[model samples]
Structures are given as structure tokens and as C-alpha cells.
Target: MRFLETDEHDDPILSVVNLVDLFLVVIAVLMIVIVSNPLNPFSDKSVVVIENPGQADMRMLVKDGEELREYESSGEIGEGEGIKAGVAYRLADGRMVYVPEAPAGGASGGAASADGAAQ
Candidate 1:
């Protein structure tokens, strides 16, 4: 009966149990912060995050669907092998207009002007 009546404060394991509880609370808070982040991986929305913009060590994170792509700058002007697909112009009203080039050997198409109107 004396063993069962031992003081709880005198137990050596009590301190360890408290420490474990503190760590569990800390981990829970961290998990909540990660889940609430806008760029969380579990999120379905696509996002683009640029780090160290315009610097030599610049990096870009592009998240599309479930795929995440990382791009690091090489400290040089980037050159890509691709043809121009369209032209964008700023109208007097500060609206952007995009004019897509017609495919080769195809009839000229009307300019799909801004505001979803055909010109």
C-alpha cells in the first residue's frame, strides 16, 4: 500500500511526461502553420513564388496541379528555343490586348481583341 501511495511530485517520470507533452504541442502548432501557408504542397491551387528576384542566386518555384518545378538562375540572360506565339499591347485605357499569330499556311484570322471581342 505504501508503493501505491507514493507522492506524484516525487516521481522522476513526471518531468519526462511534461516534456513530451510540451513537444507535442509545439509540433501541432508547427503543423498548423504549414497547412495554412498559401504555398503549402497540399493545396490544389497553382502558385508561382520568386526568390531573390533579379539576383544571381534567384530562384523560381512554379506549382502546377500536383507538380512543383524549381528554376534557378544561371546569372546570365536566358535564351530559349521557341517561336513567338502572340503579341500583347497596352491600350489607352490600360487594358492588355493579346493578338495571336495565325498559323503558317493558314488563312488570316480576325484579331481576338481585348475584352473577349473579335476585331
Candidate 2:
């Protein structure tokens, strides 16, 4: 504690203090980079998802401005005018399934016609 000066300029402690300050600045910069990264877990873009992976089993048909029909898993997809109805699904065991043909008349009439046709 002598007054005003001894030659303390050669001390090793000053270099160590400078090294500690540099490390503090590097850690602060790294924290800012981590917070700003686009792929961070809290980012908004990570939330939305898509569920389906393959062709859909159902569809809707629209004609003019009208929704003309809805289709289902029964292989009954609607055919547009030039398009003929075709067999659609093959099961995993290799059997083909097709939409059933519409009855020529109502059910009772079709039954009677079938009996007549068989005779």
C-alpha cells in the first residue's frame, strides 16, 4: 500500500483479467445466437402437420356450379359422361372388386324381370 507506484506493470494478474472478460463476451454472443435460430423448438413453423400418406378412399364430384355426388369406399366412384365405370380396387389377396350395377327398374320389378328372363 505504498503511495503512488511501485513497478507493478509486470504482474501476471492483468493478463488473466483480460482473458476472463473475453470469455464473458463470447458466452453472451452464443446465447443470442441460440435464441434467434430458426430451428429452435419453440418456433411457430414446427407446429402444423399433415396426417394422410396415400390416396384418399372418398371423393366428391362437381358439375357446373353444383356438387353432383359423393363417393365412398364401396368402389362406387362416379363416372363422367365419356368415362366408363371400371373396376377400381384390388385387395391385398389379389381379388378385384367393382361397383354393383344399378337395377334396371325398382327392386320388385327387377326380380320379376329376372324370373321372366330366365324362362
Q: Which is the leading candidate under TM-score?
A: 1
For lDDT, the strongest prediction is: 1
Candidate 1 C-alpha lDDT tens digits along 6-118? 89889999999999999999999999999987689899999999999988999999998789999999888768899998899899998778888889988777777668888
Give lDDT per model, in order: 0.89, 0.50
Candidate 1: RMSD to truth = 5.4
lDDT score, candidate 1:
0.89
Q: Flag clash pairs in model 1.
A: none
Q: What tens digits encode model 2's per-residue C-alpha lDDT throughout 52-94? A: 3234654433232222333344455666665443334555776
Q: Model 1 TM-score?
A: 0.56
